[model samples]
Target: MPLLAFWESNPDEVSQTSIEQIVAMAGDGNLRDGSLCSDELRQYLTQSDTSKLASYVEHCLSNSFAKGGQVLQDLVNELGRRLDFKVANGRYQGTVNAIGFDGIWLSPEGHTIVAEVKTTDAYRIPLDTIASYRRKLLDSAEIAEPSSILVLVGRQDTGELEAQIRGSRHAWDIRVISVDSLLKLIQLKENSDDSETGRKIRSLLTPMEFTRLDSLVDVMFTTATDVEATIIHSAAEKAETSDVITSKETSTTPSGWEFTDATVLDAKRVKAIEALAKQLGTKFIKKSRALYWDSSHETRVACSVSKRYTKGSYPYWYAYHPQWDEFLGEGSRSFFVLGCMDLNFAYAIPLDILRKNLSALNTTTTERSTYWHIHLSETSNGLIALQLPKSSRQLPLDDFRVPLDQS
Candidate 1:
């Protein structure tokens, strides 16, 4: 069976499988520079969640195998993809004619990073050779001048390698980062809502003079602040109430549902994705906190979860942000999935339909942000509808309800 099929069959053993074990299940039990096994492994990595990727990285770093370094190289490239870079995978092994870089990551702002993966810093690296690869890429116009070399080491204690780079003539053009730090950056990017967070993470890979620590501190502080804000917003959402105008032209304020648990919103959001993934017959890898996409990049979904409000005609409320809209635009087929936690159902609204009704939706604008308010109400006849502005007609959500049961 293929790697994905094998993984599907043995889901529990995937994390425990070593590099060699995974290779044996691929093409001919061998991993070459441009072989079928390499292709299969990379595809699997692209579709894997961050947890699986972290596990595989641990397997690679625990003990060296026949093709362990190559595996690490591919994982690092996938990390680049998660960080919103346009990644071009490099060779597993260097050749005489081609550049010996492991990967090239192109940022949205037009900067480039030439990546090199190392299992450890026991031996000194040939910084000149890595620099020469960058020069060759620049000469051939494969990468522009604003490119720098990144050495990804397995060990967090890279003292020797740090000394070597600091002493070398090419020190200004090369930077070093541990595999642990790289993975942490990926986690931060995956959870962040700020659009500029990815750019700042990419900036950490480039060569920068750290004589003054203000710039570095700014990146860390801003990212942490944004994450904290997201947490606070989620907590505040549970207690917030809004007036829902009924069909009879009467406005009534709803009380927030009394709930003791903190993780229910998160759980419902996860279930929404799981239920949609089964219905679509394809696995979706998370691209961001709210956005997920299939391996083929053809389908994307932005999932938002809402708690049930008490004593109102409309019991569910969701804040749809611009970032989710932008993320859904990256795919050919996209959906804005709203999970009503109490109703135990979600509406996977097509992007085109959502776009058409956006102007008729109610929006809440503040100094920091603006978002459309999505409200779901049930009728006396046991039907759900999307509540729109009083000027527009409400939309029935029964047809757009995502499949919640396996059958």
Candidate 2:
């Protein structure tokens, strides 16, 4: 069976398998460019989550296997794609007439990086050959003059390679980083909510003079601040929408309205989202604290969790942010999924219908954000319904209840 097919059939076994074992199971056990094995492996990598990618990278670097070097090359290019770069995979074998680069990564801002992957820097690198590839690309206009070379080595101990690059003429145009650092970047980007932080992470790859430490410090500071803000917003009862951008009239939560503290409901949020994913029949990738998208980015969902209040007829309350509106707008199919009480019961409201009646909902405004308040309760007919503010008619929600079944 092909590696991907086998993985789908035997996820637990494949999850415990090493890179060598996986390669052995793949078609022909060969990973040359354009081969069936290579195609299957790359497809498998793309479909796998970030954590799986990190594990595969570790296996490739730690164990020796047939065609391991070529596998590492493909892994590095996949890392490039995860970093939001437009990646073009280079050939497995270099020919005299052809450029021998491992990959070409194009940034959104038009900068180019010719990437090379090496398991070790113990042997002296041919800086001239790597530079020549860049030159050829520049001459053919395949890459612009602002292009540079990046060498991703397997080990963090690159003292020998560092000295070699410093002494070489290509030192100004070449930068070296360990695969470990690259994986951390992927993890960081996946966890972060700020898009600017992603831009800064990409900037670290661009060839630059690091003699002055200000730019590096700025990147660190920005990343730390954004991560801290995300944590605070997730935990705060009346939190600012730190990840959102808004410009609107400030309002306050209505008196007697219930507030769902995120900290109290966070544990249930994960299972709720998982249930919603199953209901929608899509594998969703986390984008922020409450936002997710499918692999194709075609479907988006913002899931909120609330504890059921004992005192009120409308027992559940959830805050809906403008940021979620913007997020859902980008998707062809979007939903605001609300999990109440034990979370066995939930409503997946269509964004279009919810958006049309947003004006009828009450608002809670903090210094940094203004969000709508959603209330849910059981009607006299024992059906789920959305209780609108200002005595507006309760909207029937029975049609939108998401089934929380293992099936």
Candidate 3:
């Protein structure tokens, strides 16, 4: 008998025939060239107009539930705003894609608290998926050690959403709520029509479904066993080390310092200043005399000298005192008791109070004792002097180590 006639006679066998045909055709070398003999079956399935089939496929893919993922994402974003939590959705890490929740809260002792969020539907919550999320939480050290809160939401049969608090562990808590409640909250802030619609849809979800969802939420939120803080810390440390190495490799030495002047400018000192500048940018300026930088707004820094200088006696030293008055002004502020040092050493002083303090310093050197000397304000353009030793004075301006200007 012919294959179609035999299959028609034994209807139950027809399914197997189609499967075998597909498998055989798929394995054939000529399959790509459309030479495989599946035209009869293809024509049967496609007997309907192509446009109709396309429309049917599109309709299937565009169902309400299929589109609900975006609604959920929006809800997550809104919740984050209300709770001051950081929320991100559809993030991919390695082969896995997930939503990330981050936030900081104050503990009873004022310590910083952190939290995470996850979601599920009426269907069974997969253990592996929950575990994977927990693993991710454990991997992010900044969020791992802080107290965590997990939130689960469910839709109800009555078309009204409901919420349940699954559990709370020490600083951590697991909570569940319905979309209706969220809508109501939103309604309180805005329009009532949306709230009413939300309430209606929330009513469709059964309580039992929500309860089961709450159980999953509880497990995900309350259970601390899945996440290990130590693991996260270790990972963070390693990552930090790797980042340090990578940074060193990519970083170029600043152009301002030359070799001959390098000795006068302590490599360690310049690096420290550069590091500060890198972090604070132009907000900080290094005081040439004190060998320390000051915030732009700060004026006088408390400095001590081991030996008081007799003003006229050290006439030659006046040139070395650094045009302090040029950089620091009279209106600058002062910090107290920074340290005791010698005339040869520089002290960081605020720009505003420089003149007031300079006037206060005793002109004559007393016993080799600590005394505060006011820095002078000299520069109008808020330039802090970087003093080089006399021998290194001629070094090019490019030899001074300064941070690259990102601005």
Candidate 4:
């Protein structure tokens, strides 16, 4: 990856042309007109431990090629391997550079399954190729009914392909599935450890990592469930009763502020928010999953929106919902920010943000570069962070729009 560090740092160097060339070269198994599958390249890679070499292979596949032929085939092979595909030694033609047949499997029940791996954005396998795979599998064993599966990686329009396959008059049966579908099958297998049939059903269901942590934290509040909303509302009510948020300071108290049951922020709403901010014609830095700019009164505006908020915390998920702080390389210039959770009550500022401002500052923690341990009881300057007035004009937190120039 260091070989690409320089180019990746300057996005200008990684043009569409270079990306295409990289993908082609990856499929061709070449670098600098030299074959990476050659003994020399293999020796060089072998100089490092297998794990590092595997990482390097993955990096090259993911970063350089954007995923391609041999790279995709290896992944497909690995998926089959990890799942303990009943058929071992499933190679065909024994091509070098991992360019052999994608995979050939014999399910425990004696059904032969032949798979063809593809990593193109849009590709249509000819009917002849499907026939050839069926013939090959039948020849390899005494199986009566042989089925074929086309495993596509990153191809978005697989539905059309599947339909075409279904309609085709090819001699044998064939099914088209995206790698994502296949992965779902694998995951279901992992989850359903009840019986072999259950696991196989998972395998048959078909299948998929990567995450945007900052974006995830920002959307965390949007996905909060009804139960979670009840808890949050109860917390707010307790604060009000305890005079933490005195009724005298209330401006626009919300009665039932909740969102529909959705865990992910809608993409269209995110675009709308961005477009609105762009209309303001002010430069705003988008970082830490929050939009940051200075308000009219010199107060820093750190605002984020949650289109969906799930009810519970997932593994590696930061807590405190809309006002969550993910010390994982996320920093805040604004002490107390606004959380637009599920676009319910625009004035219903998140308690977590307030808690963050009042709690001990962020410090190093396991999953993040910085993490905060917040408690609502903590306050500053004799002000109860949670009890802050829900005003329309008193502060910049009331509006649902991005604050770019404090307007």
Q: Tell me, by lDDT, which candidate is best.
A: 1
Candidate 1, 1-407: lDDT as tens digits: 88878887676687577667887887777888879898888888887888788888898899768888888889889888888788999998777898888999998988899988898999989998899999999999999968898999988989999999999998998999999999999888877777778788889989988999988998898788788767656645554564322332222236432342336655677788878887777778877778889878789998887666665556877788888888788789898999876666788999989888888898877555888888888877888888887556788888888766555
Q: Provide TM-scores for the models.
A: 0.90, 0.80, 0.24, 0.34
Instruction: Please give, for residues 75-152, the per-residue lDDT of candidate 3 as tens digits.
Output: 343343322223333321223343333333333222232322233344443333443454565576534443333334
Order the candidates by TM-score, highest first. 1, 2, 4, 3
Candidate 2 residue-wise lDDT, 67-121, digit = tens: 8898888889988877878888999999888889999999877789999999999
Worst 10 residues of 3 by lDDT: 312-321
- Tell me the alpha-carbon RMSD of every candidate: 4.9, 6.6, 27.1, 16.6
Cα RMSD (Å) between model 4 and the true structure? 16.6
Candidate 4 TM-score, true structure as reference? 0.34
Candidate 2 residue-wise lDDT at 98: 82
TM-score computed on alpha carbons, candidate 1: 0.90
Candidates arranged by lDDT, highest first: 1, 2, 4, 3
* Per-residue C-alpha lDDT of model 4 across residues 1-407, encoded as one tens digit per residue: 32233333443443323323433433244432234432233232212222233344344345645333554454454455334354332332343443234566655455555667665436566757656655755676533463554444445467666666657775235555666555555544432212232334423423101143553343333333323543453343333222222132223338533332222322322343334434443223222223332212122233333222222221011123333332211433333333333233222233344543534332324321233422221133422122222221112243333332232
RMSD of 2: 6.6
Give candidate 4 regions above 4 Å deviation.
1-67, 87-100, 140-146, 197-407
- The weakest ten consecutive residues by lDDT in model 2 span 241-250
lDDT of each: 0.81, 0.78, 0.31, 0.38
